[model samples]
Target: MARAFNAKVRQREFYPGNLVLRKVLHIALDFRGKFANKYDGPFVVREVFSGEAIILSDMDGTENALPVNADALKKYYP
Candidate 1:
């Protein structure tokens, strides 16, 4: 099972200063609706870890202490 999963997974890379959209963390905010935005930011990538982790910051420049997995990130072209 693990091999199958690994075979299908592709590595995604992000660089410092690159913009990306992060998956919304649902721990806080009250539920909005089915159509609510499920992702946030065009956040700045602060750093990339050797594995599937990264540090990110919002547009206003606040750095997040938590390291997010690359699976939760999507590249922002603009």
Candidate 2:
């Protein structure tokens, strides 16, 4: 029962070192606001500070530091 609860809650919490690859992510500030005009490609979780995260793009060879929340991000499991 404990394991089941943990799995359910884990789906809601976003932590550092959480690997997110090849997904359409929306980066925003303060939870709700204007989004970045461009969609970034699959990025790796480099670091998570406070409410911000440092992600590295697969292409273009650039890194972006953006503020995001767990609820504000959705993983495309397709």
Residue-level lDDT for 77 in candidate 1: 89
Candidate 1: count the clashes.
Answer: 0
- Mind giving the per-residue lDDT tens digits that candidate 1 earns over 1-78? 999999998777799999999988777665676667888988999999888789999999999999999999999988
Q: Rate the local accuracy (lDDT) of all candidates.
A: 0.90, 0.46
User: Which residue pairs clash in candidate 2?
Assistant: none
Residue 62 shift from truth in candidate 1, angstroms: 1.4
Per-model C-alpha RMSD: 2.6, 7.8
- TM-score for each candidate, following the candidate numbering: 0.75, 0.34
Name model 1 segments beyond 4 Å from true.
Answer: 1-10, 27-31
**In candidate 2, what are the lDDT values of residues 1-78, reduced to their tens digit?**
999888777434445445444334554453444553333344445555554444443334455655444444444332
Off by over 4 Å in 2: 1-7, 11-18, 21-40, 52-56, 74-78
